[model samples]
Target: MLKGLAGLKAAAAKPNSFARHGVATVLVTAATMALGLLTGILVARSIGPEGRGALTSVLTTVQMLGWLFAMGCGKAVTYTLSRDHSAGGRLLSTWTLILLPLAGLAIGTGYLLLPLLLAAQPPETLELARLYLPMIAMALLSELMLGLILGDQDFRSFNALNFLQPAGVAVVYVALWAAGRFTVEAAVIVQAAMSTLVLAAATALLIRRHGLARPDPALGRKSLWYALRTHGDVVGGVITQRLDLLIIPAVLSAKQVGLYALATSLSWLIVSLSSALATVVMPAATRRGRSGRELVLNSLQATFAIGGLLGGGLFVFADIAISLVYGPSFADSALPLRLLLPGAVLYAAAAILLNGLYAENRPFTATLANLLGMAVTLGGLILFLNSGGILAAAIVSTVAYTLVFAAAATLYRHATGLPWRVFLPDPALLAALPRRLLTKPSPVAAAPANPAGK
Candidate 1:
């Protein structure tokens, strides 16, 4: 069995088309996950439940604001730059210029609102929220840098920075705690410092490698418009994903909101795994025509299988995992985690399907699916929040994602003229693929080469 597994591994690494890039991405993802787990443990140990809850609330708010400012341009940067390198470079510069002022405005807005929003909270927690708001804003620069690296397909640099940023923040926080300088305010300061350093380094590297000497203003404008259209799904999708977080705080008590936040954090692991696969397959998917259908089907199959396995494991171990990482103070979160687990798995599969639509330039379809999903989620949450508390929130969120996934699969079939049946996962078919993987040598042929190769 050991020799067979070794042989299978060798076969998997034969440098065939997407497989080569996929293998590399898997390595990067593995490293990122490892570092992220360590960072999570450190944060849990250092700050405990209250700190974790505060960080979750602040980060969720920041994520929504950052998504709004970027306008989904980050994903668009990758797709656009991959299609036209020179044009992409100019667009990247333009986007950076546009985002700088926007980031400032967002930071100012968040800072101004912090006191008003947290006025009712405990004095210490309110103070912590205010201290963290600026750090969230500072991280926007790092996010922009990430967009540029992804646009250029510099996954090596991107992944390195990905691991570094979180790990750096964790290490700084731990060091500060060890030295008796750790406070919620100090943690925010450390976060700001790390974001500044990473953003500067990433921006400098990307500019040195891919920056246009004199970017054409006309080209930049055109690329910006095109990117907006191309990335509409991403913009809508972010709003849809974040709706519960954004609204829950308004409707629920701080403690209830905190429970929902904890559940959402657990769900994020599903997304992280899905994102790893999507990052690997996106470039390849863009190069195909009819063959993209088969690629999407195959990807969904793998994603669903993996997501199901992991989600199930998480569900089974939810209480233990929550207690271990977050301590017994957060035991209230276990049931919410279980409620969201299946939905999280479905959300993961949906993400890959949405990526497929984006590759096919069917952003309209993707956007529609996301909007519909958001409607379902919000409507359900409103109806249930009054009757049932955090559990209702989890159930509604799961239902929303399931609907979204179904919608995406339906739209993908309609757009590509692919049969709806193709969306369904067939365990028999997947079981049959291993023999083909071994005997055929190549799992799939290479996507046609594009001149840009951004």
Candidate 2:
């Protein structure tokens, strides 16, 4: 047992920067997920199916709007900063200033439409929506701050905030529930408060650590144009990725929506692992410049291996896992979970490629691919849902993600004219794995060699 334990640690300690970052990200994500699972259980027990479903709907709406307000600036920031530290810092400040009003506008619009939107819902759901919509504005503000931190590769801070935001909201919700102030409206209000507080703290820390210098007007204008173009692609990608949730609710019952939400939350375990790897790889790939092909290949190989392993494990244990995390009430989620497993794998592959595209500053292609996938998904859903229901939705999502991955792979190949197979791991590469092998150190390394490197 000790030998096995030691071997596991040794494997974990292997000289791979990506592995180290993946490990960190996994730890953080796992912590956050654990907290989320606990919170879900608590909310489920306290709020029952209807309340949880309403909360899910409200949260989803907030997320979609939040993405619009932030406009992919977080990723843009990460890609930019990874290349030019000074410009990145300046851009971060400028983005924050510009996005604040947009956040306010999004929230204002939600507030104004809340009454009409709720009037169209059941009385219970309407009340929840009314309470929930207003708080989303605060969450939007935090998202903008998140973009700043991500651009700077401040994962430690970013992860800290990520963990704190959800965990803190859970704690507040539990406290309120215990004190008999646990209305869904109150929960949303508390969530907004926690989100705003965390964003303020994170932004303050970023300014202090990175300085508050604003971008020059000319540089800011250039960066804005770059951001606008890149962000459009990101928005399209997000829509492609998240469109199912929007469509599922409209075409299916609330129960079906709840079931789908449960499956998606479970699938997030796999996607989160993939996202963690992409998060670490994106900055490194950006730093590699024109010579990023090797880095991109290695990153994809590692991501596929890790993501495949994690996703497969989830697939194997789908039933028991879903039962435990979400309760037997969500047993219907298991089939969808199993069906979505392969899609999760493809999603990870697409993510790695997307990062490479971002690093290459060819976000336009990535965006175009995403738009194509979105069209495919929407068309598939429209056709399939009429005949097949929720199952159709799952199939459409899987097919759409597969299309996105293939498109991204093709684009990467054409842009760099590199052999596409190099990005894919050969069976021989996996089969001939040596117990002992010498590997070249990554040129960029993980951390800067000196404090002044950045």
Candidate 3:
């Protein structure tokens, strides 16, 4: 009986195209959410609101700068490696060769511009931002390695490493707080150090699993060109998504930024399903010649069930959750948290649609859609944020996401001719999810028949 139970667990863990990969990603995403919440709460309690605000600002700035400099190598690496896994080593090497110099330039430029960009911040906060400078290279390299891992389809390692940085930060923060040394500078340093360690681990894993290949100049140029064309989509999407955070420091108090950050983080617990979907869908979609119709449809149905249930739960518990996780000082976060639910759900659907377009080789379509969303989001913030503050930002976010979803979904449907009804949840697929969870990978999916070689 014990032997049989072991076999059953193994079978259950083995996933194929639809339910299996989705389940694994969902589980990982759930863990990431939990860790993020735990860390957020700890940070909030340790430093209080204003410090939390400064920390959020620095972290957000680090990510934005990293992406700006990384030059879209994340997606480029993924696309290139996905197309031909045999070239995985060379692709990884090429991206590393390109990313190092770019990282330096990006960091140097950010340093020069820091005084202007963060002029509103306190001197201490600015100091913390400077301390986080090393993250520029670390964050960029992390992105490149993440793309390689995704392309290699090493979901286990991917999931493990994804959770490590946050978990590490949280643990370190708690220790520092206990030691009475949990200042903003210490926290920032801890975050950067933890992130760098995680990136190093991932790099070691990639090299161990797929030994490095000599960098190919031609392939490197091609990847760089592709990344350049499509990088805007990623940059725009992230900017729109995190635009509110960037804006809050300028227009609102650090305390308010802290509150808004808490609310969005809670709401993101639901919206982040889109990320999980994108992670699994991108490589799979890249493999199939078609728009990955079956995968997208099934994933959409799953997203609806998963995202809807999670979003509804978040909506209902927004107040209690905010209080429990962030303390009563952040209770004001509930209203914005409630307002962000619709956008979160909408964004989840749009993420899948955007990835579908990428899989279909219509990257420009995805880029344009994100640009539209960014414009709407930024314009709304500029025009209404002065009077309306976080609530207005929330409303604008929902509207912006709605427009983005419509644009991307229309393009996907028009290009693929897959009917609107196909995206709707299928009772059969929902029912099959449980069965799929308990079964081994299908022979077809295991063989990776898709031409992309994933």
Candidate 4:
């Protein structure tokens, strides 16, 4: 089994096509979501809202700190590695050296600032947060490794790692529940423990494939500059997804944060699906021609149709689902989940379009687009508190995501000189998807589009 798995990963080392990889990944992502949801329900049921809220706050803080100091290196490494697959060793070494100290710095900084970051919480929450501060490193390593794997276009290995971590988490949660030893602290410990093991396994794979070599000064400089260029969009995109959790504490109660956290967690089920569709897209987009265009177009269509259906099902059945799985305590989460559905699907589509900007070396335009969305969110938050007290923050968030999708689609077309109609799903392609998914890999050649034609 071990040898066969290794062979699979070897065969998956940068495939020339995205079709099978995308479909398989979407399935894997859906399973991960299931395991994740199970773990969440277990934890939420055991801890209740306030305890769950405290846990959520701490976890969010740790995750935010990790991304805060990441400086977009994860995505940057992906772009750099895709351009020079031979640099695996140097890239691995260089990024390892850079992110370790940055992670350490993030841990130190976050430790000092946890008081401020989680100020909305109680003393017990703050103390528990400080205990798990090292999760900052775990989060950073997670991002770096996943980005590298995806950059290699080895979605099979990528899917393996993705599947393992959540599976471990679910197993751990199940074990704890059976043992009657579940608590927020227990949840935190099990998550970090599983993460540590997963990261170790991933690092071992990287080392075996491309043994750690000295960091190349020239490559290091180039990678750093590239990371900086993409940093704004990277950071803005993360903050946009997470800012609501952090900010909700200030305006609402801790319980509301918990409710909103549950809402967002469920909402990501759709976003991750969107994301899985676009998983290989950025790398694929850089390959000039008809194949790249078709790849993007198909991804857009699949994401829209699949994401819309999932989002809609959850939207309509949210109240029952929340109550059925998480009980009446979390039934209130249904409304927020419903409010976030449209935006969630749109945000996923925006993510797909933004790949064009990155591929075109127009990272700043991508950054500007995300920044616009973030600006709307922040501005709306302020307005929501003052004048729209009667409104839910989820409504504002949905509007912000809608604007981001609009901006991203417009920017992607303008940057790539592609027709706007291409941004929409083609009915023919949608109809052909089932047959295509069943067909063998036939990588289409990239024939350049007519320079004079729209």
Candidate 5:
């Protein structure tokens, strides 16, 4: 046991490979996912299904607007910073001066347009949506700082920061639950406060480490171009992710939307495993440039093996899990949960390919892949969403997700010259594997003992 322990330490924790870094990121993601689930349970129980739907509708709307106007700066920042460390200060300066104001403007725009989006929603839902619009500003800036940490490959701090939002919300919800005050409005207010806390913490971290400097016009132009190039992918990706949430309101009753929201919230808990790998893969891909195909392949292999098992388990236990955790009223959410499990896993794996494409300076390929998936989802919803209700939404999503993975895999192959079989993982290894051992940590993923080091 002692020998095995040392072997494990030597293999993963020190050198900061995807094993080391991936474990850290994935572990934190798991913690956050668990916390998020806890928060979801509290919210669902406190408000019941329809109130949860109203809350979800407002939250989803804000997320849609924020990502819609995000301009793809996220991946662009990470890709750029991985290649050039010197741009950190200027990136901070540029975001503060330009991006912050733009975010405020976007929030204002969302407010003016909020009622239109939530028209089908109840009047209270529309009010909640407007109340949540300002949270979009907080989310945008918080994400910007987090992006910089990720771009710098400070996965340690990145993971740490990522943990805080969910953690804070979970704590507040726990308090509210104890006080018997965990209403939908309280949940919304708690989330906004947490967002402000995260943004403030991230900003302080940057200022102490590197004082803000003047924006570099050249760097801003270059980063903004890449951001805009990847912008379609960003917007498309968010649209794809949030479209189901958005559509459930218009086509289904508020109660139905509530059920769908529970399904999705549960789905993300399992899906975050692959997303952790994709998070590590993106910056690592930028660092590897064209040579990163093997990393992407390896991560995808791990994603498939891990995602498949977890998804299957959730599929089998959806009914019990829903009833046990969310109570019997949410039992109906199980079918949609089962339907979403596989498609969500596929979408999670596809993220690795898309990130690789973007990191390799092939944002257009990523953009096309995103648009394809988005189009498929949109078309599927338009033709069949009303006819089938949430079940149809689930089936269409699964199909769309599968198509996206296929398109991304094919495009990834054409772009990187990787064989198709690389998309498949070995069965024997799948049965006896830990993710860190799946691939050697790349040099780009290695960190100094210092968390804030250059």
Candidate 6:
């Protein structure tokens, strides 16, 4: 009977624990989305289109550079730490050592490229990028540390850290706006300051909870090789994701960039859901040896259902939502938002499939799909540049995402032999959500095998 109780406890903990984490991730992501929208509204309304565009460009540049410089160390750290608990300290130390030099290289490159890249922008925008570019190095360290937390599968802390910085920035931005001090520089500075605070807090917690070790060259090489294999895909993915935005300043006006950025920002809510699901999927897949078809299918159904509803809503209410949130000046952003909703959902699906590939230890395969997607994006952008403005950018983005999803899904099939039908949604999976919440675990039916009850 005691064994029965233990069995029940374990089963209850197993699925229920994952369910709880999924629920928390969804809730946190929803809250973060709301907070993010609020921040966008506040910033956009205060700065107008040109200023908002400048701020948006700076932030995007910082993030893209940070991820590029991170060189997949963060992901490598997570993958390594998830599989080998004993090597946590060495993994963290090695990745940190590797990231530092890369960070310097990244920052230097950004400095060299800034003049050429931002020369098209207004002087104010260029100045902001110059001032804030240094922060990406720090952001890289923060991201690596966050990756460590994720490796530990401490979703609670991960969710907290994810929300805290945005929440802080929102609050601080509101205060600054109320005081009539919310210039582009002020907004960017506030974001950087809040992020730094979060980073410091995260670093302290990581050290206290998961202490550090000295760098080991051999371990560093192993992690570096792993990061190299994985981060190529990461770099390609990031480029495809942000290439449109990067090109906007060159071919379009700051106001047009602002409108497009606003739409894209709002559309990322769909992407966020995919990312949240993937957070659970990756570590869970690692444990299961492979991301089985049923598992991936179930995740796909959930993503599609959630994404469909959100994307549908955004499409129908694009005008009203944009007007109400960002004011009438951003009314032009509505069509682009509508255009991006479907693509964002596709992007989300691709992300989950891509994560499945990672869990299967086939990072290089994922790289090919991502590079193909980036190439498509670039080609589409060039093709559409002269004729179409923000609208063209939006449509091309959707096309790029569709092709990327097809590429990733095909590779996933080759890797796992999963059928295409699994990607479709089912009412049964949707119904499972409530059932999981209401049902109680059954007791064990039999005892473990033992000879003579020994």
- On TM-score, the leading prediction is 6
TM-score of each: 0.83, 0.83, 0.90, 0.90, 0.90, 0.91
User: Per-residue lDDT tens digits of candidate 1, residues 1-454?
Assistant: 5764563454344325444454466567666666566656655666665565565556666666666666566656666666666655576567777667877787777777665555434567656665566554455556656766766656677777877777788678668768866655666566667777887788778778777556567766755665566456665677567777766655556666666677777776776775566764554565443344455566677677767877888889989987887777678989988988887888888888777777776665677788877788768877887688788888888888888888887876666655555567667646753222112322222333222211
TM for candidate 4 is 0.90
Q: Model 6 over residues 294-399: C-alpha lDDT tens digits?
A: 4444566677778888899889999998889899989999998888888889888888888777777777887888898788888988999668999998898888
Model 6 worst lDDT run, 10 consecutive residues: 445-454
Residue 423 Cα positional deviation in candidate 3, in Å, after optimal superposition? 1.5
Name the regions of candidate 2 deviating beyond 4 angstroms.
1-19, 108-120, 134-140, 173-183, 426-454
lDDT of each: 0.66, 0.68, 0.77, 0.77, 0.78, 0.78
lDDT of 5 at 88: 84
Supply the TM-score for candidate 3.
Answer: 0.90
Give per-residue CA lDDT, model 5, range 326-437, as digits (tens). 8999989999888888888999889888887876678877888778778878888888888888888888777777888888888777766555555677665455445434
**Which has the higher lDDT value, candidate number 1 or candidate number 6?**
6
For candidate 2, give the lDDT of residue 93.
67
Q: Can you give the lDDT of residue 282 in candidate 2?
A: 68
Q: How do the residues 314-409 of candidate 2 rate in per-residue lDDT, one tens digit apiece?
A: 889888976776678778888887777788788777887877777767767667778878888879887888688767778888787788888888
What digit string (tens of lDDT, one per residue) describes model 4 on residues 241-314? 77777666555667777888888889888999766877777765553333355566567778898888899899
Q: How high is the lDDT of residue 159 in model 3?
A: 80
**Location of the lowest summed lDDT over 10 successive residues in candidate 4:** 438-447
Least well predicted 10-residue stretch by lDDT in candidate 5: 445-454
lDDT (Cα) of model 3: 0.77
Candidate 3 structure quality by residue, lDDT tens digits, 1-454: 5764564344344336435566778788888887787778778898878888888888888788887777777777777787888877888888888888988898888787666656667887777787787789998889989989988867678888988887888788788878888877887888878888999999999998789899999999988887887787887888778888877777688888888888888778887854477776877667654424566666766777778888888889888877876788988989998898887887888888877776766666678778888999989999999999999999888888888888877877765665566667668767776344324222212222223211
Task: In model 1, state the lDDT of residue 331.
Answer: 84
Candidate 6 collision pairs: none
Q: Which stretches of candidate 1 lie over 4 Å from their true place?
A: 1-17, 111-120, 123-143, 230-232, 251-255, 288-292, 426-454
